[model samples]
Target: MQQVRAVVAKAKNAPVSIETINVPDPGPGEAVVKVQACGVCHTDLHYREGGINDEFPFLLGHEAAGVVESVGEGVDTVAPGDFVILNWRAVCGRCRACERGESWYCFDTHNAARKMTLEDGTELTPALGIGAFAEKTLVHAGQCTKVDPQASPAAAGLLGCGVMAGIGAAINTGAVGRGKSVAVIGCGGVGNAAIAGSALAGASRVIAVDLDDRKLRLAEKMGATHTVNSRETDPVEEIRRLTGGFGADVVIDAVGRPETYQQAFYARDLAGTVVLVGVPTPDMKLPDIPLIDVFGRGGALKSSWYGDCLPSRDFPMLIDLYRQGRLDLDAFVSERIGLDDIEAAFDRMREGDVLRSVVVL
Candidate 1:
C-alpha cells in the first residue's frame, strides 16, 4: 500500500480536509492511476451534504483524467503508460442488460475490490467508486478508458461526468437532428453542453433558458441561437415564440425541479421529446400535471442517467472530436486549481457562478 494526499470528507456538513490515505496496489482486474486532473462535480457536494448517503469519510472526486501507473495480472484493455479518462460505470458483461446488448444499462458494474483507508485504518468510500482527487487512486481496469493524450486533462476530465451527460441528453436521448428546434432550460455546465450538442447535431434553432444572464452569455458561446432570461420573462412563452408559435422539437430540463420540469413538459411541441438530465432531490416530487396531458403529449419523457453513456464507446470519440476542433471542451474549464483549493471551489459552485473548477494534481 502507498500513502497519498487525498481530499476526505469526514462528516456531513463538515469541511473537507487534505489527509494522508492508504492506496493499495492493484489486485486482480484493478489498476492504479496517477491522477493528472479532476473536475469538481455537484455530486461531490451532494456527498458532502449527506444527500447521497450516510457514508462518512467519503473520498470526493469522480470526474478525472490520468495515466495508468500499474495494472494487475490478466489486464490487457490498457497498459501502464496509457492515458485515460476515468468513468464510474464500469460495465460487467455478464449482466442481463449486457446480454441484451445494452451494456450502458448494465445492472452490475465493477469497482476495485480493495478499499483505500485513512492513516488510522478507517475505510473510505470512494465517491461514485472513483475517488480521484489525489495523487493516485485505485479502480477497476474497466473504469479506465483510453483517450488521446494530446487533450488537456482539465477539459478531458469533464467528459467523465456532467459534460458527457449534457451532450448525450441532446444527441442520444433527445435524438436531436438536423433542422430540429431545441430548447434547454437552466444554462449551467450541463445545460450549456446540451446547447452545444444540439448545435452540433444541426438543430435549426437552439434556445437557452436560464435565470442568470452571465450563464446565458456563456450559453451563447456554447452555440445558443437565442437566450431567454427566465427571471425576466416567462420561459415557456418565450420558447414558443422562438419556435414559430410551436414549442421546440426537443426540450431538455437540465434543472431537475418540479417547476422546471413542468416548464419543459409544456414548452415542447406536441410529439416532441423532453429529456430530464438534471438530478432531483429525494424530497422533491413531480408536481401535479394532468395525467391526460402526459398521455396526450405523444412524446417521450425520459431521465438521463450519466447521459446513458457507454464510456468506452463515447470517451475516445469525444476526445477525438475535441482534438479536431469540432467540440469546444476547453470552454468548460472555468479555472484550474491545486487540490487544496477544492473547498473554495465548492463555495464558487454553491454561488452558481463558476462552471467548473478543476483540481490540477
Candidate 2:
C-alpha cells in the first residue's frame, strides 16, 4: 500500500478536502495508475451532494488520464509506463453481453478487488468505481485503455466520461451519419460533444438548443450549424423550421428532463431517432405523452450508457482523432486546476460557463 493525496467528500453537501489516503497495491487483474489529469465532472458533485447515494467519505473524480505505475499478475492488457485513459466500464469477457459480442453493454464491469482506504482505515467508495482525483489510484487492469502519448492528458481525460458519452450518443446510439439532420437539446459539455460528433459523422445540419446563449455559442464552436435559444423560441418549432419543416432526422435530449425530452420527441421527423444521454434523478418520471404518440413515432428511443462505447476500441480511435486535429478534445477543457481547487471548480460548474475544469496532478 501507498499513501497519496486525494480529493474526498466526507459528508453530504460538504466541501471536498484533500486528504492522504492509502491506495493498495494491485491484486490479481488490478493495476495502479499514477494519475496525470482528471476532469472535475458533475457526477463527482452528485456524489458530494449525496444525490448518488449514502456513499459518504467518497473518493470523487473519474474522467481521467494516467500512466500505469504497476500491475498485478496476469495483467497484460497494459503495463507500467503506458499512458492511458481510465474508464469505469471494464468489460468482463465472460459476461453475456461479451458472449454476444456486445461487450459495450457488458452486464458485469470490473473494478479493483481490494479497496483504497482513509488514514483511519475507513473504506472509500470511489465515484463510478474510479477515484482518479488522487496522485495514484488502484483499478482493474481492463479499466485503462492505452492511448497515444502525444495527446494532452487534460484533453484526453475528458474522453473518459462526458465527452465520450456525448460523442457516442450521436454516432453510436443515434447512428447519425452523412446527410442526416441532427438536433441536440441542452448545449452543455455532453450536448456540444454530440454536435461535434454529428458533424464528424458528416451530418448535413446540426442544430443546438439551449436556454443559455453562452452554451449555444460554445455549441457553435463545437460544430453546430445552427443555434436555437429555447427560452426565446419553441425548440421543436425552430428545429422543424430549420430542418426544411419536417424536423431533424435525429434528435438527442442531452438535458435529461421531461420537457426537453418532449421537445426532442416532437422535434424529430417521423421515424427519427431520439437518444437520451443526460441523467435524471430517480424521482423524475417520464413525461405524460400519449401512447398513440409513442406508437406513431416508429423510430428507436434509446438511452446511452457511457456513450455505448467499448473503451478499448473507442479510446484509442478518439485519441488518434484528437491528435490528428479532427476531434477538438482540447476545446472541452475550460481550465486546468490542481487537487485543492475542486470545491471551487464545482461551484464554477454550476455557473454553466466552464465546459470542464480538469485537475492536473
Candidate 3:
C-alpha cells in the first residue's frame, strides 16, 4: 500500500478535506494510476451534498487523465507509462447488455476490488469509483482508456465525462448528420460540447440556448451557429425561427429540468429526435403534455446515459480529433487548480462563473 493525498467529503453539505489515504497495490484486472489532472464536475458536488446518495466520507472527483503506474497480473490492455483518460464505466463482459453486443450499456461495471482507506482505517468510497482528486488512484483496467499523450491532461480529462456525454449525445444518441439542424438547450459545459459535437457531425445550423449571454457566446465559440438568450426570448420559438421557420432536426436538452425538456420536445422538427443528456432529480415532475402530443411527435425521445459512449472507442477518437484541432477540448477547461481548490471550484460552479475547473495533480 502507498499513501496518497486525496480530498474527502466527510458529511453531506460539508466542505471536503485534503488528507492522506492508502491506495492498495493493483489486484486482478486492476491498475494504479498516477493522476495528472482531474476535473471538478457537478456530480462531485451532488455527491458531497448527498444528492447522489448517503455515502458519507465520499471521495470526490472522477473526470481525470493519468499515467498508468502499474497493472495487475492479468491486465494487458494498458501497460505502465501509457497516458489514459479514466472512465467511470468499466464494462463487465458478462452483463446482459454486453452479451447483446452493447457494451456501452453494460449493466454491471467493474471497479477496484480493494478499497482505499482513510488514515484511521475507515473504508472510503471513491467518487464514481475513480476518486481522481488524488495523486494516485486505483481502478479497473477497463476504466483506463489510452489516449494521445500529446493532449493536455487538463483538457483531455474533460472528455472522460461531461464532454464525452455532450458529444455522444449528438453523434450517437441524436444521430446528428450532415446538413442536419441541431438546437441545444442550456449552454454550460455539456451543452456547449453538444453544440461542438453537432458541428463536427456536419450539422449546418447549431442553435445554442442559455439564460446567460456569457455561456451563449462560449457556445458559439464552440461551433454554435446561432445563440438564444432564453432569458430574453422563448427558446422553442427562436430555435424554430433559426431553423428555416420549422425546427431543428435534433434538439438536445442539456438542462435536466421539466421546463427545458418541454422546450426541447417542442423545438425539434417533426420526426426529429429529442435527446436528454442532462440528469434530473427525483423531486422534479414532468409536465402534463397530452399523450396525443407524444404520439404526434413521431420521433424518439431518448435519454443518453453517459452519452451511450463506449470508452475504448470514443476516448482515443476524441483525443485524435483534439490533436487534429478539429475538436477543441481545451475550450472546456475554464481554469486549472490543485486538488485543494476543489471546494472553491464548487462554489464557482454554483455561481455559474466557469464551465470547468480542473485539478492539476
Candidate 4:
C-alpha cells in the first residue's frame, strides 16, 4: 500500500480536503503516477458539485502531467520513469467503436481496477477516471499518454482536457483548414484554444466573441484576428460583417449556453460547420429554433468529445509544436500554485479571473 497526500471532495458541495489516502498496489492493468502538475478544470468543479454523478469522496483532478512511478504485472504500454499526460479516455481495442476503427468514440474505455481509499476505508471516486490532484495517482496504463518531456508541465497538462477539446472542435469536428473563415464563441480556456487551433490550422480569419473584454484580448493573443464583445454588440451580426456579409465557414460554441449555441448556429455560412465543445448542464434546454433553418442551413453540427483527440496521436505532436514555439500552450497557464490552492483556484475560475490555475506538486 502506498499512502499519499491527495485532494478529495468528501461530500457534495463540500470544499475539498487534503488528506492522506491509501492507494493499493497496482493490479493487473494499473500504473501509479507521480503527478507533477494538474490544471483546475471546470469539470472538476462540476464533479464536486455533484453535477457529474452521485459518486462522492471524489479525488478531484484530471488534467494532469505526471511521471510513471510503477506498473502492474501486465502493463507494457508505459513503464517506470516515463513522462506522461493523464487522459480520462483510455480506448479499449475490442469496443464496437474501436472495432470499426473509430477509436476516438470508443464506447468501452479502460480505467484502473484498483481502488484508492480514505484512511477509514471509504473508497474514493476518481475524477474522470483520473484522480490527479494528489501527489500520486493510480490509473489504467492506457490513460498515460507519452509526450515530449521537454515541454512545460503547466502548459502540456491543459491538452489533457479543455485545450484539446477546443482545438479538436475546429480541426477534428469542424474540419477547419487553410484560409477557411472561423469564429469561436466564448473566450475561456477552451474557446481560446479553439481560436489558437484555427490559427494553427491556417484559417484566414479567426474571430473571437465573448462578453468579457479581458478574455477577448487574451483571445487576440491566441491568434484571433478580430474580437467582438458580445455584451456590447450582437455577435452574429459582427461575425457576418467581419466576413464580408457572409457568415464564417466554421463557428465553434464553447460556452454551451442556448444563446451562444444559437449564435454559433446562425453565424456560420450556408453549408458551414458548427461545432459544440462546451458541455451544458443537465437542465439546460435548447432554445426554440426553426427546423426549417436547420434544414436550410445545409451544414454539419458536431459535438467534440475531448476535442475528438486520440491522445497517443495528438499529445506528442502538440507537445512538439509547443516545443517549437508554434502553439502557445503556455499562454493558458495563468498561475501556478500548490495542491492546497485548488479551492481558491476554483474561486478565481468562477469569478472569470484566470484561464487556468495550475497545481504544481
Candidate 5:
C-alpha cells in the first residue's frame, strides 16, 4: 500500500477536503500512475453536487497526465517511467462494440478493482474511475495512453477530456473537412476547441458564437474567422450573414441548452450537419420545433461522447501537433494550482473566470 495526499468530496454541495489516503498496489490488469498534473473540470463539480450519483466521499479529478509508476501482474501495454495521458474509458475487447471493430464505443470499459481508502479505512469512490487530484492514482492499464514527454503536463492533461471532446466533435462527429464552413455555438473551452479542430481540418470559414466577449476573443486566437456575441445579437442570423446568407455547412451546439441547440439547428445550410457536444441537465427539454423541420433539415443530428475519440490514437497525434506548434493546447491552461485549490477553482469556474485551472502535482 502507498499513502498519498488526495482531494476528497465528502458530501453533496460541499467543498473538497484534502486528506491522506492509502492507495493500494495495482490489481490484475491495473497500473499505478504518479500524477504530474490534472485539470479541474465542470464534471468534477457535478460529481460533488450529486449530479452524477449519491456516492459520497468521492475522489475528484479525471483529466490528467502522468508517469507510470508500476504495473500489476499480466500488464504489458505500458511500464514504469512512461509518460502517459489517463483516459476514463479503458476499452474492453470483449464488448459488443469492440467485437464489431468499433472499440471507441466499447461498453465494458474497465477500471481498477482495488479501492483506495481513507486513513480510517473508508473506501473512496473515484470520479470517472480516475481520482487524479492525488499524488498518485491506480487505474486499468488500458487507461494509460502514451504521449509526447516534451509537452507540459498541464496542457497535455486537458487532452484527456474537454479538449479531446471539442476536437473530436468537429473532426470526428461533425466530419469537418477542408473548405467547409463551420459555426460553433457557445465559445467556451469546448466551443473554442471545435473552432480549432475545424481550422486544423482546413475549414474555410469558422464562426464562433458566445455570450461572453472574452471567450469569443479567445476563440479567434484558436482560429475562429468570425465571432458573434449571442447575448447582443441573434446567433443564427449572425451565422447566416457570415456564411453568405446560406448558413454554415456545419453547426455545432457546444452549450447543450434547448435554446443553443435550437440555434445550432437553424444556423446551418440545407443538408448541413449539426453536432451537440455540450452537456444538458435532466430538467432541460428539447425545443418545440416541427417534426417536418427535422426531416427537412436533410442532415445528421449527432452527439459527441468525449469527441468519439480513441485515446490511444488521438492523444499521441494531438500531442505531436502541440509539439509542432499547430495546436495551442497551452492557451487552454488559464492557471495552475495545487490539490488544495480545487474548491477555489470550482468557484472560478462558476464565475467563468478561467478556461481551465490545472492542478500541477
Candidate 6:
C-alpha cells in the first residue's frame, strides 16, 4: 500500500479538502496509474454536493490521463510506462450489450476489486470509479486506454469526458454529416464540443444558442457559424430562420433543462434528429409535448451516454486529430491548476468564469 495526496468531499455541500489516502497495489485484472492531468468537471461538483448520492468522503476527480505504473497478474492489454487516458466504462465483454456488438452500451462495467482507504481503514468510493486527482490511482485494467505519447496530457485528458461526450453526441448520436445544418443549445464545454464536432463532420451551418454571450463567443471559436442569444430572442424561431425557414438538420441540447430541451425539440427540421446529452435532475419533469406532435415530428429523440463513444476506437483517433491541429482540444482548458485550487475552481465553474480548470500533477 502507498499513501497519496488527493481531493475528497467529506460531506454534502462541504468544501473539498486535500487528504492522505491509501491506495493498494493492483490486484487481479487491475492496474495502477500515475495520473498526470485531470480535468475539473461539473460531475465532480455534483458528487461534492451530494447530488449524485449520499456517499460521503467521496474520492473526487475522474477525467484523467496518466502513465501506467504497474499491472496485476493476467493483465496484458497495457503495461507499465504506457501513456493512457482513464475511462469510466470498462465494458465487460460477456454482457448482453457487448454480445450484441454494442459494447459501448455495456450494461456491466468493471472497477478495481480492491478499495482505497483512509488511515482508519474506512473504504473510499471513488467518484465514477476513477478518483484520479492524486499522484496515483488504481483502476480496472480496461479503464486505461493507451494513446499517443505525443499528446498533451492536459488537453488529451479532456477527451476522457466532456469533449468526448460532445463529439459523440454530434457524430455518433445525431449522425451530423456534410452539408447538414446543426444548432447546439448551451455553448458550455460539452455544447462547444458538439459545435466543433459538427464542423469537423462538414456541417455547413452550425448555430450556437446560449444566454451568455461569452460562451457564445467561445462556441464561435469551436466552430459555430452563428450565435443566438436566447435571452434576447426566441431560439427555436431563430434556428428555423437560420436554416432557411425549415430548421436545423440536427439539434442538440447540452443544457439538460426542460426549456432548452423544448427548444431543441422544436428547432429541428422535419424528420431531423434531436440529441439530448445534458443530464437532468430527478426533480425536473420531462416537458409536456403532445403525443400528436411527437408523432407528427417523424424524427428521432435520442439520449447520449458518454457521447455513445467506443473509447478503444475513438480515443486514439481523436488524439491524432488533436496532434494534427484538426481538433482544438486545448481550447477547453481555461486554466491549469494544482490540487489545492479545486475548491476555488468549483466556485469559478459555478460562476461560469471558465470552461475547465485542469489539475496538472
Is candidate 2 or 5 superior in TM-score? Answer: 2
lDDT of each: 0.95, 0.95, 0.93, 0.93, 0.93, 0.94
Q: Local error of candidate 5 at 260, Å?
A: 0.6
Off by over 4 Å in 6: none
Compared with the true structure, the alpha-carbon lDDT of candidate 3 equals: 0.93
Task: Report the lDDT tens digits of candidate 2 across residue range 181-263.
Answer: 99999988899999999999999999999999999999999999999999999999999999889999999999899988889
- Model 4 regions more than 4 Å off: none
Give Cα distance to truth, residue 18, candidate 6, Å: 0.5
Q: What value does the lDDT take at residue 349 in candidate 3?
A: 98
What local lDDT score does residue 240 receive in model 2, on the 0 to 100 scale?
Answer: 95
Full-model lDDT, candidate 6: 0.94
User: Weakest 10 consecutive residues, lDDT, candidate 3?
Assistant: 282-291
Instruction: In model 6, state the lDDT of residue 333.
Output: 95
- Residue 150 of candidate 3: its Cα lDDT? 92
Give candidate 3's TM-score. 0.99
**Lowest summed lDDT over 10 consecutive residues: which window, candidate 4?**
147-156
Off by over 4 Å in 5: none
- Residues 176-267, candidate 1, lDDT per residue (tens digit)? 99999999999988998899999999999999999999999999999999999999999999999999898999999999999999999999
Model 1: worst 10 consecutive residues (lDDT sum)? 300-309
